[model samples]
Target: MSVAMKGLRNHITPVSKIIITSRSKNIATFGTTEALQLDFLPKEAFWYFFKTIAFGSSNPEEEPKLAAVCMEIAVLMNGSFIGAHVIGGILRSNLSGQFWYTFLEYYRYFTGWYIHLQGEHQSDMFKKRSGLTYIWSYKNWSAVTATFHLYQISSANLNDLPVIRTSELLTRDIKLEGKFDALEWRSSVPPYYSYMVHHEYGTGNNHDVITAIESISFTIDRYYRQHQGVEENLRKLHRMLLRIQAIVEEAHGRQITNQAMLLQLRMVRAVMYRGYYFLDNFRYRTVQAHAQDEVGDRSLGLSPFSQFKRFCFSTRTRKIASEVLDQKELQKMLGHLENIVSDMQEFVAFVSCYPRMSRQPYCSYLLLENCMFGRQIEQEKIINFLLEPNHPSAKGINVLPIIGPGRVGKSTLVEHVCHDERVRKYFSMIVLCSADSIGGGFLTDTGLIKHRNPTSTGQSLVIIELADDDMDDRTWTRILHNLRGEHITPVSKIILTSRSDKIRAFGTTEALHLDFLPKEAFWYFFKTIAFGSRNPEEEPKLASICMEIATLVKGSFMATHVIGGILRSNLSAQFWCRFLKCFRHYTDMHISVLGEHPSDAYTKTSGLTYIWTSRNMSVVAATYSLHQASSAQLADLSPILSNDVLTGDVEPPEKFDALEWRSSIPPYYNYISHYEILAQPPDMLPKRKRSRSLSEGLV
Candidate 1:
């Protein structure tokens, strides 16, 4: 075919265009010009097309339920025009919603089974232009009488073979005792082709249990020797993690605009974090055990009794180590990491296509600690919204409401977006106003007006930071009115960020909601900060302890830095264990009394919370009524720090100021807390909660 096309192309007139399209890459190479590869249709376009054909003359709006089911079927089609026609024709023949739902259920089952067996969605295979043939063998099901196979074949004589439609296999029960061909699809356009699959039914024997056991025994003997295989697998996983990290770092430095690409990047990041979590947990535990052995050996010298005690301890340690470092588990981890690496082959290739952004020359850890973490998608959305031109038919200024829980980085995201080079270049003047400032008439202030860019007529970007959720509709309207009156340009945009969801209603566009980082992402961020410039593998014991501390910290950005700094300062395992004990006690006590985690209480509500404070070599629980939580410029922060108070280095007065954390990134403000220590009656003292020690299970 390629040779024929090549010869035919040369015979064509100079002005004539010869367009060739094929599913095969080899056939595409025969073209003289660069091949234009087609991707799946955009979701919106596909939905519209699917709706038109599926409903035919019927009104989709009249049957909302059927339309919903049709949408699901359309998604399953994966933008295949052939699939849409076949499935839509089936539904169009019977306009019952129940029938459509039944078809959808069967379709879902077929696709799900394919995904389960092949490790990818059937739709994905369609998108890849892979042949429609898929083989499934029911080896374990006793209900099946014989094995069945599916194949895609092309034949001119359709009447000679027993034909069955793929839909019949899904929608109806058909008994087959012999081989037959299933018609999967038939192209209706030019060069009409038929997609047929051959199904063969036969019996298959199950594996012998004795032989399987022997094989398993051999594998155990080979890989479980002195845990050498486990170590090798760990090394492989570590190398893979490093590769993923390199790609992720490069991606972070680039401006990735494609939504699909961003989603893939996010998946890659998740896999990378999971790999690191497991790797770090295993390596650190091993290192800590070895360190403990060294300490034990030094303490218990060569005396007969000491040697006997050492032997017992070593035996117990080895047992624990064996349980933790199971070779099979290590193999599983390695396999997963390898699979992720394989899947990312294309993602890594395309990551390089994105344009790189100008970044500071700081170390990755430093950058992670100082910059916002795990909100790339949200950041992109904000930037896109800000840079987009106002719709010609739109009225008033554009408002984007960013709503999130307290300390969830809503303000930081806006600050970063405002600082973006594109945003700075697009807006002539950037005005920042707080809820208080708005209420205080800062918009009409003569001093603020005087500082505006008078000569430049470019649009102004107004950023309003609302601290509470109680902003009324009237107030919001007044703010917009005031902006219009002052700026005199409706094109000027406004970004409203608040800790409450109430402000979301005031936005002209969809509100961007911010949430705390997932456990995996937060662990990655915490680990980076906790280890600073040091390699975690070098201080495995500390790394192990840091994971536990991060788990207890409950995704608090302030606690991450504070606790991370404390642990980094003192690398001793003993100190880390002590800190972990204190933290655990703190959280457990709060959970017991308040019925929730202390961090949750701190961030989610403005209520009187019991804070952890130790004194006189014991854990002394102190109650503090949170008066106000506010952000201030670094210079304005109180001298007293929360770390000092928590560590019992300085006992604050009844009512005092304590600095929580100072932001190292844009809009760098010191988060301060004004609280009054509550006096607890002796009779009201909470009972002590007992918990496991770090060394209880392991020697």
Candidate 2:
């Protein structure tokens, strides 16, 4: 292959480009021109591809139910084209909702599809100044080994650099390993809760394990965090936790701790379990909290026997009555949480504040082709300002400020200008600085302006992103001074981006205020993200929905990305309408995509955002209530409250708050209300009342 490529390169005259695709790294390296490795489709792109394949030639809008089923299956396909093709063919053969549901059940156990976690490659580590090298391979899947040396890191940091290795899956009866072992901590090992309790119950019998799983699944539906860690005092908490788990496991054994403290700890443990499971599996049920009173109600039948069993070996009633513990428990629970949170915050602060040597700042310079939708004109304008000669009378370095609100494409436009062929030729060196990198001794600390070559001179273009308004004038003045000092070229220039108008004073040239995308351009960009390559003419109904969605989203690139992501997996009219109904609620509400909320089901680890209602009140109560009831009981109660509960007509009592929100709702009503919130669109409620309904809580 190398010889052939060399021969072809020698024979071909005026060859401008050469493309090569190979499973072997050595063969790919034979290309005389630049060799690039292909990357797996991103989540959004993967979903779009699956959606198209699953519903080819037919509008998913027609089969909302089937589309919904397909959506669930698509998420599991993980970026496997082969799986999509096979699954798509299966779905295409049948359109029945029953068939789809059966397919879902079958696919739940299907293990044909798999996601390749990070892969490792063996290669010699090259020394610094060798620059970057890429080597591709096709073991397991196509992967590229990136080799480079950053002078900023010591030998210790290199050793600490996380090495990717294939990890074993946690399954039935796996022995506990590390304290942070992903599954062990989550308590999702062999002889799962279901297996343990299932044997004791007859047909249609409800088990404590079932309730626990249901509760976990319910919690996941609302505030399902994929992973959460309980803050341990590292000072002998491990032995205590292990002991607690052991006692909890034995149906007849009990560990006597302060009843209130035990409940508090259990609550913490349950949250931790849910968080971990939230991260591991998309559809996993964890049993966090269980009712002591409800234990083995049917298994040993009769209340007296249950009481006898409890009296013989009970964790509660050792220190205090559980009912007494419940009374005024809200305040005590809050106090415990506050203390825990305070300690966690302090630990976070200490970790963050730990001293470390500064390293050279790095940024990706691979200019994305056609990424800047409406930034062409802005790029050209910035180029004119950047390359434009400084005034003859002007002294020191000149600064050009590009200002805009967050996510208004300021960085993108400047990036385009920075990477422009003209600008590349014009500037000898280009330094990109983010807001976080700025502080006292900014350039020196970041290694942006190397002191080793202090005497060297070249026309440099320094790009500064002013992230915060807190940057004082002294820092800005010092930053400008260093750019054009004796160490830098006399003609060096600076360009800055900021959301603050106060930064304009620092700009030697007039500030360039970035304008929001024009309606045509904005919609064009929105369509590109939301629709990808799907043709509007072929899917006019979806196209129209897309147009409406554009208006509902905030006019920002980030907003477009988020809404487009939500739409990518969903193509049916019902899904679109559902999204539209809640569109205002989502946009208006403070949706934290960061997924750091400890109490939210949609956790940072899970990367899945559960659809939440805008109605005021925490969803915790509703989540817990649904968890307490069995599926049959929940099913039976859904019909009675289906109409009023969801309509916002069933109002909470006057003087409702967090405590009342928890204590007031019966489990049946709570689940029904939650389901209503999840299923019903906000469009059903009156505008004035809907606006008024929003309270300061999770729902």
Candidate 3:
């Protein structure tokens, strides 16, 4: 081989131009890479520490001479590793005609592919870098050994160089670069999760265990990292990470970090960069353009005899025969170069398939994903609410109520329900939100809010919102039109609110008035908020104040939120004061609106905003029965007044539309309603007269 390498001074083939250098020697002994200028390194430093291991350098300053000799002898015990002497069935089959014919005869034409696998080369070592747990044999020990030696030497200064022996390269001062342990890598070893990176960046390849030389590559090093103590092997692993950082930064343009993915991904990206650079920067992924006479360490295949020269001697040229060839010859060489590129791309794609086979991040967060369904009351209510619309029994037993004062939670309840995946999947899509609620997650500008991120243009949408009387009707109509576009699903439903009877003019969807909770549920729910438990006895007075507010809550989600905020504040007197004030405000607002008694007016007009005919008053009389209604009006009114239960033909009250929105009501409370207040005192129409008028109109 040495004689063959030396004889390479003659022939000048064009192949020599492609590879710049091919490191052949175990180059690490050169040590303290600081000896070389930083410019000597390649780009792609953003990866983690340890991806910078190059095979060996070309003799850059030397004149064109015989190239360095890199003899890669991989052992294939069974086609898996180089020779450990166990011929696995796959290799045994390869030993026959097909394998021998394909590789030995044909693959040699492909530079890196056809090498001697039949030969026996055996050398064993405690995988120094892979953790002492491994004992790797020389399957392709020559290249592996050379690589390890080169990096080991480069890492150490001249004073720290390891001596190479016939069988093994050993040093009293042990320093192992993790990148060389191929055995530590294989399929069975647990793969390391490269640290998280911004969502846009990801590692495209798995680490080649033998070649992965950074902190993120192995578990042992990471474990060593968590603690600083030196427990022999554990200590060594930690130091390996530090060295990896140095080489990766100094040699490759990588930024290693604990963030996980940066290291390995950088290396893979570098690999791609190299192919691109080769094909582009110098046409390396292609065939060489220069004549064989061109000298350098990488021109290993050019000389008829320089087959022995490797990357080690690929730097400066020593042209023996400067006489150039003609154009016809150049064309022939170019054709061959094109073929090589075709072969190389195939090889790169083959390596690319492995990583896709290994990703499982999507399905791993099962526990965390289920956290949204936490509270018992919340769960039941949401579920029942979802089922109400479709259930046959739900028609008469329906639950619809706008539980809010000004800015209460009625709309929020609707929003949460719509966003829930279960609810999202339940209906093709349901209209659970109101118009007053404008902001949503994936909406486009100009009110074109789409329900899903990657929605198929025709997917259903559930629009929820909260509206105020001040907002013009035109705005709500436009919002509805936008919601109905093909970009969103059909008009599942529409819910609106107004303080005046005229507002009933815009009732677009089936309206259900929302009233406050019953005193019992309120007692339990309020106690939990005010005293942090369902035990009302813990703070009876506070619970009492809350129950009273619940009656005033009038099914107002916003009011509950305000009261919830008050209780959460932990101030006793202030809470009572706020409570009393809220009731007073409710009373004052009522007086200023209707004539201080809504039920009297309810008997006159079944609807809050419109002038109900004598017929409408008959329906209103059935539901109100001449009593002042609290938030619990519906629940309070449900069992009583058998004949005329305001199952009227009119819409939900204009003043209290929040109570009517469907999606806002929780499921468990299948029934809730908030009849509009008249703001007028009870009228004194003779009972007999009022009864006669209502009955006559009904007839």
Predicted structure 2, TM vs. truth: 0.33
lDDT of 2 by residue, 1-699 (tens): 657656666543755666766655776556666677776688788877877777878766444445657777776665664456556665676676655665553343222110001111111111122333222111111112232332233334434543221112111122222211111011124422110000011233222222322433543333213112111221123333343333322211122222343344345444333322222111111110021123321111111322223211132211112222222432343344445544444333332343332211221112111245444435555766767777654475777888876546576677656655556667666767765564445344543531122233446677777646446788876665555555433436778887778888877778888866655445555766676556443554455556656766545554465456556655655555445544433433323222122123211112222223322332211121122234565455443332222223355332111110111111111222222222333332223233324323113
Of models 2 and 3, which has the larger TM-score?
2
Q: Rate the local accuracy (lDDT) of all candidates.
A: 0.64, 0.42, 0.31
Off by over 4 Å in 3: 1-410, 426-450, 453-457, 462-510, 541-699
Evaluate model 1: give its TM-score. Answer: 0.59
Candidate 3 overall Cα lDDT vs. reference?
Answer: 0.31
Better of 2 and 3 by lDDT: 2
Q: Which candidate's lDDT is highest?
A: 1
lDDT of 1 by residue, 340-399 (tens): 888887887898898887664432446377777888667877887877777553465788
TM-score of each: 0.59, 0.33, 0.23
Per-structure clash totals for the candidates? 2, 12, 111
For 1-699, candidate 3 gives per-residue lDDT tens digits of 446445655567522322222243333343334232222112223111111111123221120111111111111111222121121212232323223222221112211111111112122221222211221222221221222221122222322422322112111122333333211111222342111101111233222223322322344344335323323322343343333334322322221222223333334333332322221212111122122223221121222323323312121111101101112333343344344434444434333442322112431232212112112223234434444343353322222323233322344345554555554554454444445444333234334343443342233444444343344669656655555454334333333433333444444323433334444434334434454423443443444445445555544433343345445455463435343433433332333333343222322323332122212332222122122233455454443221112222244342332222112223323222334434442353223333334233323
What stretches of model 1 exceed 4 Å from their correct place?
Answer: 1-223, 285-333, 361-367, 435-457, 486-491, 613-638, 682-699
Answer with 1 or 3, whichever has the higher lDDT: 1
Off by over 4 Å in 2: 1-370, 434-457, 470-472, 488-491, 585-699
